[model samples]
Target: MNKKVWLIYGMLALATSTWGSAFIAGKYAVLSFEPATVAFLRFFGAAILLFPIMWIMVKNHTKPTLKDYGLFAILGLTGIAIYNICFFLASKHAPVIKSSLFIASNPVLIVLLSGLFLKEKITKNNIIGMIIALTGVAFIITNGHLLTLFQLGFEPIDWILLGAVVSWALYSVVGKIVLKKYTSVESTTYAVAFGTLFLLPFALFETTWQDVQLATWDAWVAIAHMSVFVTVVSFIMYYQGIKEVGAAKASIFINVMPVSAVIMATVFLGESFTFAHGIGAVCVLTGVYVGTNTKKWTLFKRQNKLRVQTKDSA
Candidate 1:
């Protein structure tokens, strides 16, 4: 494997780690604020951080066309605005660890959607990997009770988190196409700016001056972390990783997010580390290793064999 590819993977690993922790931040923020308010503040903070850089980039290039603007708007709404709202709402009711497991399913959804629209082929390995990852997620969320899905009461947050996953998958696949025409930074900046715009009215209705006035220092710190790390840095790294490794391969890294979140929760929030969590983590790691490494090993063996044959001929 290329050293640069490994570097990109490392960056993505860090990005996913930061994202996993954002759930904890989101949970805290939503305790005192409405979901829309939290979403608004997060994006508003991101816009503040990204706007100057975006302006500098814009100054160096020509303004985007109307079509480009439309793409930005769509990306903004789906990826930033809608995704954050659903996530915050879900985190309000569900444990962050549980939500992370569901969110990890985004990669599987992305692969399926890509295969549907991009004409990507789905192999047996892909199916096996997805099933294994999803089964682990099921265990985490359902606590090994498969039948609880039809139980008397259901947490609406689970459905909302699932919606967030779907929205993020759509955002990623659509952004892949848009990135063909724009640099990642430019695309992200416009999308975030537009998303903030789209979220403004809803935030206004949901948030009040009193809420802002009443926010604690911890709340502000959480918002800042979400804006800088989860929103800006993570998105930038994710796009870079996807560029280095194609989306199909790049997405599998999402499996790490849930495990990271669970660990963070256990350490910082005093959440219990159950036997089920360990089992699910092992399953997820096994699936990722089998799915990603098998092909890599096959290629390595083929290359070595070719080298040996060439040496013999010489």
Candidate 2:
């Protein structure tokens, strides 16, 4: 509502849009590069871009212990390495909009997982949110006929994309451990470094000079967009968004990512938006709203206020 809030919201939109566009970019890049190469180059370039920032942030900080290094390695393996590889594969095989939608479900999955592993409360609203989201997921994967899931008509690629979502959610959930010791940026730097290291062997054996030479200028441009905007600049803005707005408010901004991805993919990649997609998208977005905005909604606040007054009187 205020100037600063407007600025932060704008930045959050920029960050989400950049990330969403990365899916479109990846679709272009993979035409010339192997999926592994795409994954490797992304974080390798991201590491190069982020190093100076990381250095500036951590230069005077205390050195990490061996245990810390171990945690960083694990985060790198799960979040950066595995997640990147799976994501690239998903992009290669699945529709961009579908992949983005699956990604949009991350918050819901994180909520479900948090309840199980982190001993976090799974509120009634959260359960309602998960059901709404999963129903949307079912609709999309089944092409608007939820029974299609029973028929096994969905593409293997769709399943692969969904698996990538799980991998990413696990990355977020588990990173809490490393986050305890380091700032998000610092943890990200170490994770990217280690992840790139893990990707190197596959990149070396799988990606050749011929592949690089065969890549088009447009493909390289796509990679640069992802490496610079999506990986580095977007993350910096996201962190700032978190600082400006609380994490809860900032977290809701991520719902924009899928919408942006769908728009970019439709415009650039010539993807079609169908009635089924519209219905499913609405469901998914509504589910996110219900889940993330539980405390922010007017009705929820009014109910809380009344409950407090009742308690006091009693």
- Best by lDDT, which number? 2
The superposed Cα distance between candidate 2 and the true structure at residue 279, in angstroms, equals 1.1
lDDT of each: 0.78, 0.84
Please write out the lDDT profile of model 1 over residues 1-314, one tens digit for every residue: 89887898898888878888888898788877888788888888888888777666456654789988988888988988899889888778877767776676566566667677777776556567678877776666777675775673346676787789888978887887887877778888888899889889988898889988998888888888999899887977887788778766666666667878888887877778767766666665655554444576457768999999999999
Q: Judging by TM-score against the true structure, name the best candidate.
A: 2
Tell me the tens digit of each residue's lDDT in model 2 across 1-314: 78989999999988988889989988888888888788888888999988899888666665889988887888788788888887888788888888888778778878778778888777877778878887887777776888768777668787677677787777787777677777888888888999999999999998888888888998898888888999999999999899888788888889889999999889988988778888889889888788756666648768899999999999
- What TM-score would each prediction reach against the true structure? 0.82, 0.92
Off-target runs (Cα >4 Å) in candidate 1 are: 1-12, 55-62, 150-154, 236-254, 284-314
TM-score of 2: 0.92
Q: RMSD of candidate 1 to the true fold? A: 5.0
